[model samples]
Target chain A: MADFSYYIFCAMLLGGALVVLLSRGYVNAAMGMLCSMLGAAGLMVLMQCYFLAFVMVSVYAGSVLVLFVFVVMLIGDVKENSSIWRKIGIVGLWVVLGAFVGWVSPMLSQAAAGLSKTTEVVFLSQAKNYGLVLMTEFMLPFQIAGALLLAAMIGVMVVAKNPSRKKARRELV
Target chain B: MSYLINQTATCMPALLGTADCSYADMALFIVLKVVFALAAIIVIMCFAALSVVAERKVCAYIQGRYGPNRTAIPIIAAIPLVGNFLKKNGLMQLVADGLKFLLKEDPLPAHVSKLWYLAAPIMSLSPILICACLIPFGVWWDSGGAAHPLAAANIDVSLLAVLAIGALGVYGAIMAGWSSNSKFPYMGAIRASAQVISYELTMALAAMSVVLYMGSVSDSPLSLFEIASAQEQSWFFMTQPLAALLFIVALFAETNRLPFDMAESETDLVSGFHTEYGSFKFGLFFVGEYGHVALGSALFIILFLGAWNPLPYISYPESWGWISTLLGFITFLVKISAMIFFFIWVRWTLPRFRYDQVMALCWKCLMPLALANLVFYMAIAAI
Candidate 1:
């Protein structure tokens, strides 16, 4: 049953990614992304990392994808005219991605083989364990990531604010 | 196979009739689980349907008018006191409304995207049904006097699961609005996504405060069952009033109830995201809203109102066995009914806020308040 579920989730992940790559509509693409995220989360659950799985669903699929759909709707349905340069760029990107994957696959398979040799696989199942790891070993990296997010938020606020209005207010003063 | 069956039968004597079967125990377990889940869904859906009638009746009573007191079945209406009582309370209207939705012509508009229009209602209702599985409705005490939550799936991170599943409900509204291909619905969808996203933060933050407090008092703070069990001596509302208040307000917004129901504000937007929906499709959206309300109320009860516990400092005696479980379930139902009534009362009493005001209140007022509440609880937890 576990292996069967693993294969099913793998199919879902690949199928969803294919849909994201091939779908025309922005909404369809977003939904495809959601399906992919759910598949990944399912795999995470299968790995017994329940806390991370739920966090993935809540943070990425829930909030981020909703925002993506929101923006897509707000922008209205406009078909992107695939210019020649864009088509070329897409092909070039795919070639690079394929080459990178080709380079990494052997090493990944080797690592997996080595990992299978190890009897015990440590997995963080509890939120407290995750908290402890973040606060201790990963403290600096986590804090830096948080600060980066803060900076990005402030940047958005700054960019979103009307510069002309600010200038006008300054002139009035 | 015979040996397998014999081994299983010896361990599980309840399946004596299926003693010859190989996977009888596993099949029975799966079937029983599915049945329990279906029962939970049916109960929630029934509550949603009844709450519709309750909303109408409450609105009528408040406005000094009779609402749907005449809809009655043929033979059932001819019966004695029971029929009269049902007629007087407009209980039969539930049947009438349901049949009307089912039997009515399901119209498909030319302008709308058919696929998304079809999918939206299912998307809306399924999340609520899924979340219902995580709620610890009441406690069932075993012979050993240990308490077990009467839930479909009692997981460690059920609270997070609820929030994650609940957040996906936005897709239904967004899809409904976007697929309608109309101005009002598009606007409503925009409003819905924004409103849901904004209030979700406050809701999570508020719940986090409770979680923080629960961490100090309980073993597993993230589990709804643990949260409820921790509140056996004292309800969280007494201690975490501000978090409770914030959570309640966020709940109102998240469910798109008044005065925060800018998505479907009838005056401005005809029916908001569901403007193009008709017949059973519209009914699904209606039921989904009430289902959210029902689940949200149950969650609130679990979090702040002490779950199956009757009152503050008062708990069900484990020695009473199944009777205690029955009483606990009844108490839970009664509490949820009162919360639903409170939802209706507030809806009828308060006027809708302007969209800008709603956003402003969420960001400027509620967000900061929720953050402060979280900080306060964090400090308390630290001490």
Candidate 2:
């Protein structure tokens, strides 16, 4: 049952994320992105990295995709540029697909083999253990993530809020 | 290299004492770590709920209106095991506030497609959830006095995982604005993306200093634990204070918290991407933001603060015996809370930044600083 769910989640994650990457409509892409994020989180859970999985859900699906949709709204009618999608479609999409498949398969297989190698599973306890380590041992990265946030804060105000030099052009589709 | 450290750490107890410490058992520990993280999550969520009250009371105090003084109930927790004691105001103020959110109108404008609009908050909250897994709270906790694994999944590439997932929080803001099909939210989203992506590089490189130090130790590569344990007399902050400061600032920006919260500056963005959302869905985004804050604080605790070490100046505590692990866990919480409180204090004290200044700081200031910090770290580590 667990293996079955794992496969389903991985397929959805990869497929949904790719849909987001490839789709023209920002809304459709965001939707696909949302599903992919959830799927990714689920996969992380299956892989036993519960903390990373939850963070993926909290940060990506929760914040990033919302921002993407927001950008579309701000840009408005600028999105009608069918030529961009056509260009991507006409170009090396197959190559991107092939590369993705090539990378994911082996990692997934390794993770699968690693999981089967272990026994004595205590799922929730691992999350708790993660708490202890973050608190005690790996304290530096803990602090650095904070400084990163501050800089990012300053960056957003400058980049997103900085007005464009030229007139606001038409929105891209 | 991390694995070797983990093996040595685990086997130390059996090598010296009596418990059977095995890697397979350590793997089971991944699940155990996740359960303990619930306290951190619950603690912060409890505070964020209180933050709503804090925000309201402050607003009222400024306007001379009475606020939230009436909701205090007889302090008693009703739950089974630990809930027998009288609690604080029943801790129900947030619940009351949460109910209001649920009853409020959830309005999606006619111009927007309903599907994307409804999905924004959940989407926003989801990714931050995944990032928490790599964090190790306390070494393992059990009867056997063996060294325990800390995180749920301590993958070799957790730094990469953190960077990749932390980058995702931008989506929630972007999605909320775009799906609403509103003008202001959309603008908020675009600003958010540029701001977020720019700082990410600095964050990654700033982190690289430690990784470089650890990775470069050719004679004996330090696991995160060993590096953590190595600080007998000092935290890395003493040597890399500038980088530590830089990282904290970046973390605030990373989480879109106040002063740094340009993504949804109230004066201009008009609630930003989430303007169209209401009730629990909106609450999800709000809580998610706090969740980001909480996770960021936790990360700060682990990476630069010397993690579970009780004090930076003391090095190894004389009492750091089998009994001290429990105290280490408690002290860790206090540190995290202190950090979280700093976030709130900054939010209350500072005004929001103008978008231009925010961008200029990241590219011009932080990026350069981060690069310089990297060079310095490498130079010193090389010696």
Candidate 3:
């Protein structure tokens, strides 16, 4: 029963991701992105990463996708706004992801089968695991990501809301 | 690992007890518990609604105006033989109000995203139900006579899990307002986000103190039972009265009751986030509000009131027999009712706080007070 649900979820996920890549309409694409995110969260739950699944729902769905939708609306280029160039642009990335999932899933199951001996399901149970992993193993990358987000936020605020910059630019022009 | 297997094995007896066995069975067994938890809330909501009618009646009677007693219908009219004498003054006053809402057009203005507008109510309802699942209604016992937990989803991380689930209820309001594509919805959403997030901190901090204290109180075989048992001779509030007080206040605000009802300051924002909602969609927000009140009341009773204990008198696994369990369950329900009544009473007595005052009280009054309370508790624990 679990496996049946897993396969059905997988099908829906892939279909949604495919739609995200293929859909001409931005609305449809955004909807597809949400479906894919939801499917990923579902898979995390199935893998016994319940807390991570919930955090994914809370953070990605609640905050990140909300921002995404808000930005899409704010940008308001609402024509079935897919172009041939952008479609072709992501084919290599799609192929790579497809290849990775196809190869990794079997390897994961094989590894899981071997480790079925230990029998302790500690998958994503501890917040500290992700925190420690972020701080230690991926320290530089995480720091860099934080720096980038801060810089981007400042840049956006400056470009959009800085009155002096607008005056300075106007004077310069 | 064996524990999980053993639990699944034990569940066989439960599953075999009825083919129609369900979460509902577990849910029904908690009936007395739910009443204890929700009694005050049911009373308050009933009264809060009744007060709305009473306010109208009072206004009419005072001004020499005829109220709509003509439309009264008998819902199991209590008057003796003649059904007409027992006629309710459109006793379906609530029904009429309900039908008006149901038949009233759901005014989804062109500006709103239809999907989120529709999804908001469902979202509102889901988290409230999920929060209920973690509430310990009774107890679990093994065949060896060891006590087990009564909560549906008894994750070791249930304290934090319940908090997280409870927080999700805010999203429904947020989305309802933001997706509605109107100033009222937008303003309501902003108020909701600010209030929910603000009160959430104090609520969490207050709850966290207990969680931390629980760690100090017990190390292994640690259940909510332990938390209650730790208070066997004395409730936590006696030791941490300030924390308990902070918690209930936060609970009320967290549920968006009066005094913290800036989100639904209808005079200002027109039903706040749900101005556009009508029918069952509107009902979700309505019931969700009461549900939060119920859940908050339950948590308050559990944490501070020593759960189902009549006094902080009894201790040990042996003392918790079937009859005691039944009595404990009743005692718990009565506590919940008392808390809920207190909530309703407060609503009637106290007026709404202005948005600025609400924010100021939470940030300036509650937050600092919570920090100090935590430090005091920590100091005591250290000693």
Among the numbered candidates, top lDDT falls to 1
The candidate scoring highest on DockQ is 1
Q: Which stretches of candidate 3 lie over 4 Å from their true place?
A: A5-44, A49-95, A101-173, B1-7, B10-75, B79-111, B140-143, B218-230, B314-320, B375-383
Q: Could you give the candidate ranking by TM-score, starting with the highest?
A: 1, 3, 2
Better structure of 1 and 2 per lDDT: 1
iRMS of candidate 3, Å: 6.4
Candidate 3: TM of chain A?
A: 0.67
Model 3 agreement with the true structure over B113-187: per-residue lDDT tens digits: 788789889877777677676666555455576765555555444555566667767768777876787788777
How is the predicted docking of candidate 3 categorized under the CAPRI scheme?
incorrect
Per-residue lDDT over A1-173 for candidate 2, one digit per residue giving the tens place of the 0 to 100 score: 35567778977887776776666676676677777778978777666565567567646664566556555555553443567767577446845886898999999987877866345554432333565567876689998998999999999878877465434543331
Off by over 4 Å in 2: A1-6, A17-27, A30-173, B1-44, B50-67, B74-92, B140-146, B216-227, B230-232, B315-322
**Candidate 3: deviation at residue B72, Å?**
6.6
True contacts kept of each: 0.46, 0.11, 0.00
The alpha-carbon lDDT assigned to residue A35 of candidate 2 equals 77
Model 3, position A127: C-alpha lDDT score: 45
TM-score, structure 2 vs. true: 0.67
Q: Could you give me the TM-score of model 3 versus the true structure?
A: 0.69
Task: List the DockQ of the predictions in order.
Answer: 0.38, 0.10, 0.13
Which candidate, 1 or 3, would have the higher TM-score against the true structure? 1
